[model samples]
Every structure is written in C-alpha cells, then in structure tokens.
Target: MISSLRKDADIIIKKSIDAVLPDEAVKRALKGFKKGTGKVVLVAAGKAAWQMANAAVKEMPDISEGIVVTKYDHVKGNIPGITCCEAGHPVPDENSFSATRKALDLVRPLGEDDTVLFLLSGGGSALFESPLIPGEELQDITKQLLACGADIVEINTIRKRLSGVKGGRFAEVAAPAKVYSIVLSDILGDPLDMIASGPAVPDTSTCQQAQEIAARYNLKLSDEARNLLGKETPKELSNVTSVITGSVRELCTAASNAAKDLGYEPIILTDMLSCEAKDAGSFLASIAISNSRKGDKKLAFIAGGETVVHLKGTGKGGRNQELALSAAIGLNGLSNAAVFSVGSDGTDGPTDAAGGYADGETVSDLKEKGLNINLYLDNNDAYNALKAVDGLIITGPTGTNVNDVSVLLIS
Candidate 1:
C-alpha cells in the first residue's frame, strides 16, 4: 500500500511542477506583446528567468539584446543574443550584483520608442537587486528577515525601500522606454506590488509599514539599512505595462487533476495556505487521520501556498521539507496515509531536494535506525532525516516558481 501511495505521489508531484513550468505561460503572456519601434531588449530575472526568456526568444525571435539573471544552475543553456548569468537566491551575493549591473546597463540608454521585455518571476527580489545600501549590509538585513520568519510580502515591503531597481525604480530607470512586464506570482492573492518586490510596478507598501515590520521582527539592521527603510520607494510609475500569467492556484489545480485520475476523490483545501511550516504539516496530518476513519474511500487533500520557517535551529531545510517531516509525527501508525510537500521551483532552501515526504512507516524506520524524529525536528534537520528514510524529493531546477504544494493522501 505504501509503495502504491509513493507511485501516486510521484505522479502528482511531477504533474504539479510540470504544469507551472513558465514556458507555455510566458508564450501565452507574450501573445499580446506590443514591441516598440526602436530596439527591443529583454531583461529576465528570478528562478524562472532562463525558461521565460528562452520561451520569449522563441516566440518573438527578433529581440535586439537580452540579459537573464537567475539562481545558480537554473540556466539550462545559452540562448542566442541573451547573456545568461547565474546568481544567489533567498540571499543576494556578488554574482547577483554583477548580473543586475549588466541588466541595468542594458536598458539605461533606451528611448521612448524602445521596449524592455522584462520577464519577472519569483526570486527576483534577490536576483534583480541593486542596493541603496552596501551589498553586505543588504544581505545581512535579508538574512535577518528570513531568520525572523518574515512572509514574502513583509520581506518584499522592506526590500522595496532598500533596492535601487525595486519598488518601481526599474521602471523609473527605463523611463522613456516602455517596460512590458510579465510576472509569475509566487505570493498568495497575486499581489502585484509584492511579487519579486515589484521591480516594474508601483509600490503600495509605505515607509510606515516597512518600519513597523522591522519593529515587529526585531530585525537587526545597519544604520544605513534602517535609514533606507524609512525612505520612500517609488509610489507611481507611468512607463510599465504589466500582466500576471500563473500562480499557486494553477499548481494546485494540476495536482487535483492528477490525484483524481488516480481514482482518489481530490479536495482542494485552500490555495492561500500561509502559516508556520510545522503547523501546516500537522494540520494536514490531522485531516489525514480524520479521513482515515471514513472507510475505504480514497482521498487526496491539497493545500497550496508558501509557508515560512522561523529558523529555530542551525540545521538546514526549506519550508516544504520541514512541513513533511513535521507531518510524520501524526502519521506514525496510519497504515494507508502519506503526506508530501514540494516546491514548484524544484529547489527548497539551499538544498538539492525539492521537498520531503512521509508515510505511516516513517516513524518506525527512524526508530529502527536509532534516529529520534524529535531531535531532528528540533534542530530543523529535515533534509538529513528525510534522506535517511528515502523521503527526500529531488527534482533539480524545475524552471518555474508558483510557491509550494502539499498533499495528503489516504488510500
């Protein structure tokens, strides 16, 4: 039974990630693209930057020049006329700065008749950075926010004020040149201003809100960063036209269909799940337990959204892995139950694995190997624990980012 569940889990996971690959979505979004009379340059940034840019070049092969800034190893190969540069993610590094500089230089001299086909996606806040403060200081502030469990919107709110190219400032830089921005949202509710810190769109987050989030998180900040937080971001931009192509809702829908095809009754619990990673996992396990008692009706419960990890320990793991490991505690002895969570981007945190999975046998498997689940969870070591139990789900660089999806299966 567990073997069959794993097979079904694999199918659902593959289908979910494949459905949000950004290739089709990018091409669809570009159907209405109105290329300017002057030079048409491309600037793609985020985890999905390479994939989106590749699709655009194929769709409209006459782009004058291009620059793609994406997370390390996400670039598959060279695209004609496009310079693809890999960068750090969830935190910015020197490569991020260099790549962003190249992008900024590419569009600085454009005139009113030119068009910047800006392919924006999740992870762009880190990939597309141009700091108002020192780079080291900006990285430290980002680390502080992540450590404090700041949500994407909250993190982006603070990031917007500190970045030279974020918060509609990129649109400002490309002024006189039109920016046709196509975004792939990873945030719940598809908030245009918060996704990838809204490089081309006007920011609605204010100085007061940024300061308050800093206070709430007790974020340690340099004096420069602190001052920048109080500084205003661009509240209006006139040169950018934007459209959102895909999000977590699409990821969940794909999973639901795959599960139903496998003969399970699929229930979409929510597409806006936002909470602590462990709590989300536990909630899913509870649902699994309740439904396990309802006889032999196979069911798949799905939740889609990004969850935060509060960083209570020094060990490594992403929100999705942590969620699956936490669910193991409640699924210990349930014979026909399993829980799995995976990131649509095919990378979770700094690890190679996309996410983690657990079944009824997971607890016993750990105990037999003399590993305590509590100790692992306390240290936030889901990667190692899941690895030991063959529960890690690794699908390298899926070329898209729609957030995360967790599924509960009872068979």
Candidate 2:
C-alpha cells in the first residue's frame, strides 16, 4: 500500500532524528564529566544551544553562571541559571557580535581552578561570533562562504582566522581554567576543529589554507579581514578537552535499524555523503534504480551528510530540498519508488520546510499542472516547486543538528 510505505518511511526518519537529539547526547556526555569544586560556567552556542544548555543544567544544577547564544527564536524559554540570547544565524548579525562579547566576558573572569563547560553544536559558527573586523565585513565573508561550493572545513579555515575567539582562542581566553567541550557534530567525520570553527580546539589549519580557500572561491575580503586571515590563530591549548557526542553515523545507524524493523532491507550507503546536493541526489536515485532492476522489493537506501550548493540563481531552497527535487527528476518513471531528504535540524536554508519528499508520481503530478522540474532545479527554486506539489517536509525545529539525511524507498 502507498500509505503504508509512506508511514514506514516517516517512521524510519523519525527514528534517525530521535537518536541524535542534543539533550540526550549532552546528558550522556555529562556522565564522564567530573564536577569542579570551583566556579562552573556553561557556554552553549549553536542551533541546539537551548537544548544542550538545558540538558547540562539538568545534569549539574550547580552551574554558577552561564550564557546561551542561538539563532533567533531557537531559545524557547529561560533556563533558571543561564542567560539566553538570540542572535543571527547562517550570517552573523550585530546581535551575534554582542552575545559573543558577553560569552567572551563570561570566560575572562574565570579562575584557574574554575571550569567552563562549552556545549558546541552545528550553526555555532554563525550563532557564536567575535569578528576581528566589522560586523558588515564578517557577514559579507560568511555569505560568500555559503554561496560558494567550499566545504565546512574550507569555510571554517577562513572563519577561524577572522574571529577573536575561534580556533582555540576561546580556550585561550579561559586560560588556566579547564574547558570541557561536548560537541554534537553536523559535519562529516566529526572533525572537532571544523565544527563551529573549533572555538575550543586548537587550529590545525594555517593562514595559507585560509588564503588558498579565499583565492579558490574568488572571495573578496576587506583589507582588515585579509590581514587577519594571513595571521595565525591559536595553535595550542592546554586547558581544553573536546568530545564528539553525536554525529551523522548515529543517525544513519538508527535509520538502518528502523527500516529493518519495518520489513525493508536497509542499506546505509554512506555516512560521509557529501558533494553538490543535486549530484548526490542523482547518485542515490541511480542506486535505487539499480536495485529495482533486480526486482527487489522493499528496500531502503540512506545517506547522511551536509551537501553544498553553489548558488548560481537567487532562488530560495536549501541543499536538502534541492537533493530531493533532483532525485524526483531521476526517479520520474520508476514505479513504487519514493525519495526524501531532510535536515536533522528541521530546516532547509531560509525555508520553513525541513526538506522534501517525492514519490514516483511526483513528476507526473507536476507535469499535469504544467510545472517544469528542470526549470525549477536550474533556478534553484526547489522550495517553491516542491510546495506546489505538496512535497515539502515541514518539521519545525527538531532541537538537534546531526546533518542531512537522504532516503530512497523502493518496492
């Protein structure tokens, strides 16, 4: 039944998401933390800042003081001990600068015997910020990084150079105090230095790498920004320890198990899935098509990672939406096939939609309404196109960010 398959798909995806909630991951990581006798301060930054901070406070209610900075509207309520501040995301705003200053100040007063629990997660690179240059220039550079096809590692290489507190500089600010950073990684391989631009970890990247990235992308930076990027960030930190508590691997494993329970043979194609979003979608569709040729029934193929989208068009859509749209085009003539892509954070770019879903009939449905799928893809308008076909998957704020997940179901 079509309805049954759709329900099964939803179940699999939900399992993936539930396995990576920031609260659960933080709570697990807290078991390893030894309570400090001196002042304990918490600094949480990312899209999941509120959830992570709430979990930390729940685990250790004795936090002396704290600050939580997240994207606007991500902070749902007040934590009794922590000051919650909403800031800009995907691009740093003036609020981002102010909140980051407050966070830095919170660390500056720490004693040698004190402890700073830094809860880091995805989107922190934008939500947590202290630019060496003006806010306007930082925003411009961030926009360039997002619009270009450069990966997280590359973007962060440039960012750490321009930040006052990134690339282990935050740890330096909290010097003589122990900084415990529990991180939920949204980047592939769970690279600590790439996640949130490695605020609490040492910079393994060099000024040459930053310069190369800007040059490769043809990114125009201000004179001050250029100078900063050529300089080095902190390369060592003795007081910081980082632990990756969650990542895409966990999300993929959960999806695999859920699909198996639903009587679908699940294959975790890759956890390191990256590349352009559209190309990745097409490749997944190809795999589905190959399996379908074998007359296999009830197969679930999944891939997880963040993909980049080089913006050639000003159209509104996130990488996940673009992925699903591209998959829909590739699976146009395939019967009993469905493809979906979702951001674990429950948002795709600037759109409210988490991502998208398309069945075998999606192309036909669009055709019947005189919609051109190729045109939408070329314009990078997947959000609008998928909305027209009722293909947008809108899940508001999952309170976590592991990465993106792509699923293909065949019967």
lDDT for each residue of candidate 1 in 1-411, tens digit (9 for 90 to 100)? 998999999999998888888999998999888988898999999999999999999998889999999999999999999999999998999999999999999999999999999999999999999998899989998999998999999999999999999999999999999999999999999998899999999889999999999999998887888889888888888898999999999999999999999999999999999999999999999998888878768999999999999998999889999999999999999989999999999999999999999999999999999999999999999999999999999999999999999999999
Error of 2 at 323 (Å): 0.3
Clashes of each: 0, 0
User: For model 1, what is the error of residue 183's alpha carbon versus the real structure, in angstroms, after optimal superposition?
Assistant: 0.4
CA deviation > 4 Å runs, candidate 1: none
Q: Which parts of model 2 are misplaced by more than 4 Å?
A: none
Clashes by residue pair, model 1: none
lDDT, candidate 1, equals 0.94
lDDT scores of the candidates, listed in order:
0.94, 0.88
Q: lDDT winner among the candidates?
A: 1
RMSD of 1: 0.7
